[model samples]
Target: MVGREGVAVAKWLNSLGFYAFVLVHRFPNSETGAQAPLDDGRRALKIMAESGLAPKGISICGLSSGGHLGAALLSEYPQVWTSPDPEMPQIEFAILGYGPISTNAAGRTIIENKPPLPPKEKQELYDVVQPDVQLRSPAPPVFIVYSNNDPVVPVTNAYRLAEGFTKSGAPVELHIFADAPHGFALDSPKELPVSKWPVMCEAWLKQNNWIE
Candidate 1:
């Protein structure tokens, strides 16, 4: 669903001189199971680290479900089963664009398939994969952008995420536009204030020394 959007963002970030990669992860479904996406993410980061392009630590920017994947990876969920690889690179920062942070709330809906997982199975996955619930100490600095009136993902999810970061003593910047639909991406109309998110994100990156 987000493949083209991911490509667009990567191209824009590249124009800004960032070494970015688009991770087209497998969906959390009956075939691949719940942990599929996050495992792909962790592996992707390991590959990026091996590439030696990110000398100054890596960053993650994800849209929608991809955002949830990034957060879950950062949160290091199912810690017993998913210990960090010895050579895994540090995640310096993250940008989440309208991620569904609460598994019981918005996230479950995203992962629920046509022939949804059995309730017991679903709850077990949710318990260990919630990013807001699992936010750890020294949380990576985050920049979040979402529309207050987003029709698909509740705006409250953004609040929950920011609150998690705050409680973890992590630096977080959140911007909620008064109105916009889900998945506007970089194509938000110029008249809509949501279109300015990229500019705001760039400014935030510069202020945090993530970019010049």
Candidate 2:
């Protein structure tokens, strides 16, 4: 969260009058592996809810892998919160910036970051952690932005996510720019159309009545 990209995005959101919280979530290489991020994100939402800083409820936003974490929170919330605590804060919406959405992409990324694991264990983990597969009906609204020319995470990830949410009967908006490399964040050149994502996202929030 302390990275330049995160700080830039947070400042931009704050300037727009949104109480943006940059979460420094745990990495997949940690002891809990892939589950570490979900645990941290859930706890962060709980804290934000108790703080009462956002009367309109909290929304999750992330770039690249961070976006995957936010999406996971929405997709896996039901199974993770089996006890059904009424007080548990739910994500009002999600904004994903070039996130890798497929299970193979996620599993491959994790394996690259962490120590080598047995093939069987890796496949099992991949099978269980697919956010697109687990996306159920009545999902929170999602705003996705990506560049078709992104070299890191393919645009297919974005397409698959949009398809998943649409199939699940959730309100979803997707914007695909013709250019812009991966991890563009808020630093995309002004000349590039991808830089308009923040403005478009703000409009989306207003359209959904999340902000005035």
Candidate 3:
């Protein structure tokens, strides 16, 4: 899901002379399905560490499911079994845009308009995965950005996530714009490109000193 986006982002960072590394899966069967983008992010961080690229720390940027993956890295740390990968790169900072965090029981209905899921199957996965972030995990500081006009992932998802972080004593901030739509990075309704989210996103990382 993130290879091309990662490469573009890495290139953007490199243009500013930052050491950016993009992680692509080794072979076929490479899909990071569902919320599995979290694993992909971890693997990328691991690759950087093993290759001695950014051994000590790294910042992560993800959109939609990608953002959810970044959140999962913090909210579900221990349960994540990364096979034989190297030490997990300590996430210094994370930028999440339109991500989902809590996904069961009480919070399932928070999103007023999510695509219908199978009554038993997908909802169970939500129960299994998202709630693991109920303050049980050690989290890095986070930046949550959302567009209130999002037709897909409701803006409330971002608000709820920020609330969870705050309740857990995790430093988190949110930015909500009046007009923007789902997957804005791909196609924005505004005259400007949705890709501009990365501009403020990168600034957020630097503001927190997660990246130089």
TM-score of each: 0.86, 0.82, 0.72
Q: What TM-score does candidate 3 reach?
A: 0.72
lDDT of each: 0.78, 0.73, 0.62
Looking at candidate 3, the ten consecutive residues that score lowest on lDDT are 26-35
Output the number of the lDDT-best candidate: 1
How would you order the candidates by lDDT, starting with the best? 1, 2, 3
Estimate, for each residue in 3-120, the C-alpha lDDT of model 3 and write its tens digit: 4456665677777556876555332122433334445556777776677666556767676666655666666443533434435766776667776556433457566555545544
What is candidate 3's CA lDDT for residue 98?
76
What residue runs in model 2 are displaced by over 4 Å at the alpha carbon? Answer: 77-87, 103-127
Cα lDDT tens digits, model 1, 22-98, are 99877666676666677778888999988989898899898887777778877755754554453446788989988
Give per-residue lDDT, candidate 2, residue 133: 63
**With candidate 2 superimposed using the best TM-score fit, by how many Å does residue 94's alpha carbon deviate from the native?**
1.2
